[model samples]
Target: MFCVSENLYLRDVKLSDSSIVAKWKNDPLIRELSIGLDTKITNENQESDIKKSIESKQPYYIISLKDSDRPIGYIRLNWMDNSERFGWLRFGLGEERGKGYSKEALSSFLQKVFSNDTHRIDAEVYAFNKISLNLLKSLGFIHEGTRRNAYYTKGSFFDVYTLGLLKGEFNYIKRDDK
Candidate 1:
């Protein structure tokens, strides 16, 4: 497991985790907003993906509640450029979508991202995804701008909003106290 909140842990997705991952992705409620893939989720797929995950030097974690230890969501921390100390994040929650955990989980991930001494953390979300937009804004990610029709899926390309948070912005969070 990986540490997200000060006392919370996030585990890596494993081949053994295929059942849960598939379940997480297959849930119509969760998949509608966060899914970026169209392929079927199988053990072979999970195994192959696990290899890629294991090979990456970046941070990736699965979200779980502090009380139940249930795998409710997943988060990925990766780079947009190799030369700069910068990255983007993608997140999904199976059953915890509206329970205020998105903000909590993101807060934790932001803390983790800044803790690594990085310069910036960015995100790109579909414009129609108001829940995600609000969640990110609530955590202080400034709306930088929009990438016009940057993502094509389902039928037409949708505009994606770009947002970012800086290391300095997280300085006021009472991390230890929380």
Candidate 2:
């Protein structure tokens, strides 16, 4: 899948992206915010994961700068239903963090998902991840519930906020250029 935004584009993940992806996944900041295990992952391991993701037909895309087509981040949707309509969303930026790239990338990707007949998308954010929470909310995802002390990391427990956006609830206006 390919999606073009004003400043960025989302493209299918290739096996060649493993090294860079591994680098980003291993970053200290990324590890701190991620819900996944903090253990470092090898490029080979990331390639294996990418292979599995492709075989499973998951919506995994690299977010790249439109000008240079250089990948700076990734966004993926893991289906939670048998029909493949409901999914859990995950995304992270590499060196592009705090640059207003996420909002544009996510907005374009969410538009693509909804247009493809996706029913709903859910995202889990740790209570301390205020930036992510606000980003999701800005994109029309509602705060469904919260799991108190659901995750333990960084020597502390954190609440997990569950946010969901139904197709009917998504407020996106397709640009003429898209």
Candidate 3:
């Protein structure tokens, strides 16, 4: 899958991206914010996971700058049911955390997915990750509920907030020149 916005674009993940992806996965700050296991991942393991994800035809994408084509992050949709319409979103950025890249990338990605018959998207963010929570809300995602003490990390448990966005609630407008 490929998606283009004004400043960024997203393309399918490739095997060559494993090394950088491993770096992001092992980053301390990234691990703290993510809901996945905190165990460190080796490049080989990341490569294997990428291969399997590709073979399974999952919507895993690498977010990059259009001008430099430099990969800064990744976003993926994991389907929740057999209908393939409802998906759970997971994303992370490397060194480009505060550059507004995520918003553009996610906007483009969401537009593409919604246009492709996706009915809804859900995201679970750690309560401590206020940036992601605000970002999702800015994109029209509504706060569904909170899972109390659902994620244990950094020697403490944190609440997890569930957010959902239906296709009808998305207010993005696609520009032709992008």
Question: Cα RMSD to native, each candidate?
Answer: 3.1, 2.5, 2.5
Number of backbone collisions per candidate: 1, 0, 0
Clash list (residue pairs), candidate 1: 2-10
TM-score of candidate 1 versus the correct structure, residues matched by position: 0.81
Give the distance in Å from residue 97's predicted Cα in candidate 2 to where it truly belongs: 1.7
User: Candidate 2 has which clashing residue pairs, if any?
Assistant: none
lDDT of 2 by residue, 95-122 (tens): 9888778888998998888888699999
Worst 10 residues of 3 by lDDT: 169-178
Tens digits of lDDT, candidate 1, 22-75: 677777655556665454566667566656766875566778887778888778
Per-residue lDDT of candidate 3, residues 135-167 (tens digit): 898888999999999888768888999999999
**Per-model TM against the reference:** 0.81, 0.92, 0.92
Higher-TM-score candidate of 1 and 2: 2
